[model samples]
Target: MLQSSPKGSSSLSDNDNSSDLKSTMNDISSQTNENSDYSILPMDVIVDILSFLILSKQSINEYCNFLQSVHNKNHHSIFNLFFGYKHWDIHKTHVVFLYRNFIVKGDLTPYESRNPSEKVEQDGFIMNYIFKHAHTLTVDYCPMTDTYCQSLRKNKRIERFTFIGNRKHYHSGLCSALRECESLKKLKLDSVYDWEFTKLFELASLTYLKLNTGMMLRDFPPQKYNFDFIVDIEENQGSIKKILKNEFSESRLKHLSLISSEGFTDEYSVSNLMKLPALEILFLENQKITKQSMRTVGQSNLREICFERCLNFSDSGMEQLMKVKLPNLTKLKLSGCGFNTSNLKKVFEPSNGEILNQLTYIELSKNQNMKDTAFSKLGSFKFENLDTVDLNHCVSLSSIGILTFMRSFSECIRTLKLRECNLDETALVTILKSCSKLQRLDLEMNNISCTNIEICEITDLSNLHYLRIEKNNLTDIEWLIALPLSNLQLPRKISNYGTMQLDRQIP
Candidate 1:
């Protein structure tokens, strides 16, 4: 056992701190017997451990807020009010520790007033120590003003960079500074245009890229005729493909999230991404995808793919993609799409009389066309590997489909979501009785019309902790009251039925 050393004054210098540390180690050494394993520790090993602790930049209480008022948020706010958002005030002789992240939100402060270079280089930081230590930098709602541009010019250690701003930020200096980040690896930007896309070509280490808000927006959107939306499919296919190929030519980008209405057309743009040697996880959200687009996806080597709210990816489209046998795919989320029972049957039963046996998690939510037939072909395949199943908002599914799925994967499935699916009393009863191993159960908006529910004595929902039966009409509380609910999360709507507490632990 080690003994506590006497507390040193906060004004202790580096030499004093080192002396105190050595004294503490000597005390430990003195207490340990020759037979003790700790007594055999090499002096070099002890020094190395202490060195790592000092170098890791972990802010303990003393390191974070020890002696100075510099660590106080109010002091920083007061300083920001007078001058600008900044770190240490060196004129006050305040010693500051290393910071892991630096964020700038432009909404609170006016863009024009502050000179960020003066704040970063002169008043606040000494030798740009703060930026040197910070690895992650987030610039949200901030345009490419000269202030931030000059500030970011000194960001040599930042690895993950996120910039969320509108399309109006058009400063060439800002663009050049971001493009020249030699240490940058992951980037998430919003409202990227054709001109902005070219700025990313210089980043050689970028791996994860997520560009939101329609990357290819046409300049002159056509007048309202058949639809009021801007269409860029035919005009920007080649433009998008050319930019992507050039941008990622030498880059080893792995995870990519791109908008896919006109962004993914015929095998032109998405196929370009597949050519990337390390590209794996892809997110294509909220678009009208065609068979040609699906064809490109089916042939890719993506480990995980999500097609959320792509209405044109119908039953036929999903079936064709599934038949191709993507051995690399482990997680497939086709939520809010057009897939239903008929085509989704291939997902539940395939690969030598078993289901898509490789999939660990499959989400088929918001498919209103799903019915009893969707689960009709489900076999007792090795579903032990499948952990989560989400069929939320499939209102067309009756008790038959719900029952079939629950009976098949009750023992294996840990998280089951069937919210807004219009479940009745029989479905409710079956769920509690069958899905005993469920850790999370979401039966929200089901409105099971049961004024008096019979709590089944034999039901084994012992493992269930999270329950979201919100906006439901199951009035009976005896069944819920009987379970071993140590930390059960009940919906506020369920409390209206009886004297039940809504707040358990914000699940």
Candidate 2:
């Protein structure tokens, strides 16, 4: 009878413990239900959160979580809207993610622990999956093995391909695969050698090409042809004529960009470059381009030209360039070319008065020697279609010169950058008053100090959305309080009054 009583007590205790466990689980489930109620959030709020996660750089785990969230919400439509259809397709975004994570960042720790052959196979599988639907691809610092190259050959729809090669590893298979991409239209190769241009030019569908030779030709093997091989020809005319006689003569190539490459110092190279009659855009950066080269470039049917750090290009080079009657030329950029005020006049006011009537954009940044005289002469020229101008770091120009220049181009100017220029309060006011159509203005690092009354002039710029006036001596705060600015950069030394004004006005 005593043993039976003990067993009954044990059963009672077990029952009580079971009841407590069930109660605790019920409380936890209730709390979870309360936390999982994301339905209260508006659709726009959820979309904003997702968009931020997609655009911002995040850890792989975070990205996976975002993808899972996106899947759960069935909000794949946000990707289409976030990355505009014209800029990116759904497949392009996926490829970008793969490239950014695995190639660019070199974050392959998860796969590195695997066996070598297994890792290669896994990488190939992942790459094939991502690139199966991609139309445009850019590869930088990522060496392509034979397996990957063979996979690339299968993508017949790829239109644009950019490869920035690694110096340590040369992948011949990749180049061989590229040669078979009959549908490719645009190709960009950087720091690559041993390429057969004859085969590249054979790509009848190719229209755009960019070649950047970061290392000198002497560093390459004797068998490898430098990108500047065209310029290396002693008889430039004959070489160019030969190319014209070759299959490339009828080639549809239109845009060409050569950067940090050698062999463009002489007239022959220049003449040879100009022989490409179908060329429409030419970009020369860090090249030894002389006056003769500029003349040849100007003779081309090019609609746009960019020259950056072309130290050999002097006033005479600019003069010769302006002399040509390039009716189709509309955009020009001369950054860090060391051209001065004197050269500026030659281009703007050539004796022939053959103005760049179609010109719409001009950039003359980092021309430290440019001063008031240059702008004064520029004002005399007729830039009827001029809309955008960047004169950043042209520190020689003072308030008077800038004021005069702005007043001249006021009617057509829409975007202006005067960063680090010697602009004072008067110049700033003058710009505000004259550039009625100005949409963006940058006056950072200028000597602009305005009184409360003087600052009122800013209100007149109704169309201005971006205004950068940092490092200025602006002491007034009241004028900025009521302005409907979409973007604003204030002076570093904001007074207490200014802080209070901003706090009160911002909300």
Candidate 3:
């Protein structure tokens, strides 16, 4: 196994990022033991992976598995099949591709089914190239032919599979072929025909499942789809929740995520998703659940809970959920949900807030309703184990309230994000003074000490190695020169004068 060095030393520009990723890929060829016999992959195979590596947009975690095939010589079968451009031309290429459960097509009109034969032929062509480097099969907008499923049964190398909106009949052969994939552990489904879900979930090897309907949900549509496994939000009360519980009750799932389309049912539901005995993480996206749906959140064994873009997930609902027995929770993220200061303050004001100290990462970004008063009130409490805090895009916040907010976790905080918060020099200075353990700081898109280049110095942030100061109001280059920086981002200024300044500084 190749060991990754500290990733804090890479440059921040896009061009530098490309070279850095290339260097990391080359490291794979050189890191293996010289005496060990291993298959040398052709250049095209390596380039297939490199095409997707955007160092500036991606993290070092993506490279951690580069050497997975080196130890097992048999895995060299991956190289036997050339991918992407092999035996194909530009006309067949339509969009970005990868091995994952999710991808957004650039535009549907271009790839819209021209004809059934052509579509299946294109899909089969795609499936052939997709698994040469990694085995994640995703069937979307294309029929699953016997050839591909038969290959899957024979190889049985696929560990994760995503089936979205594919209506092909799963005959006995197809089901048997899928069952042969004992390595499959994670499954994602957007749309499935009636009665097919029972056969799918019966796979004993599956430990993670997600049911989602994003982008096409009509307003106040029934929370329950016609399918037996459908799970939706409050409308006609607990009907959706009841169906969800009954459908998945017997499964041995460890992680579950429910994402409803961008609409909430006006009706209410009484039951909670926590009743699932084996669930460890619950992620809800774009669905509005009532307080009753989360009433027993404290009773679940969940260690992480995330709600993204779920409007009307009210502050009172959040307060009720936090007051329960969430002793095992280690991470919490609530973004794009409207939570105001008073209600936000109450979640961690004191006695009712002690369980929060156990969380290592917490993000309340995009909660535009939060103001200075929330953090000011929270300053009285201590978040002992919280290492990361994301207060990004909380425009209502200024330096005063944020300064007070930092007091609660400043001692233990390691990664802090204050992007788009419009902070000033005083608050930034206070952050440097207080957060001694900070390693990564993102203060992008802020007005922080933007105008004055003097009287503000961050040399005190001794442990800080990654800093994002892009889009600030700083006056000149001198302010950036004084720091013990490893990965530094230049302020956004695109004038001729800016170009000259860069030349002068470097030359």
lDDT of 2 by residue, 1-507 (tens): 001122112222333454453343333333333234333444444444343323322222233343345333332322222321221212122333321122222222224524677655545555554344346776655655676677677777777887776654446666677777888899887755544533565677889988676556465543233224333334664543223435456667788777756633343344455556677887888776688765544356778888887877865677787776677888888887887777666666534354455778888888888778875655455557789888899888787877766665788888898988888767766677677777778888888665633555565655676677777776765556555454444446655431221111222
- Tens-digit per-residue lDDT, 1-507, candidate 1: 111122332233544475464454345435443453332445664443233222211122223232133433232211222123223322222222223454544443222325677544543332233333347766666555565566577787678877777667544475577776778888887655444444554477878877655444353132211111212223364543222334445667788776633543222334445556577787777654544555544355677878787777777667766755466877888887877676667656635333265667888888888787877676665466677888899989877788877676777788888888777766777777776677777777876755445565444655766777667765676666665565665565643752333335435
User: Between the candidate structures 2 and 3, which one is better when assessed by TM-score?
Assistant: 2
Q: Positional deviation of 163 in candidate 3, in angstroms?
A: 4.8
Ranking by TM-score: 2, 1, 3
TM-scores, one per candidate: 0.66, 0.66, 0.62
* Span of 10 residues, lowest total lDDT, candidate 3: 498-507
User: What TM-score would candidate 1 get against the native?
Assistant: 0.66
lDDT comparing candidate 2 with the true structure: 0.59
lDDT scores in order: 0.57, 0.59, 0.58
Looking at model 2, how many pairs of residues clash? 0
- Of 2 and 3, the candidate ranking higher by lDDT: 2
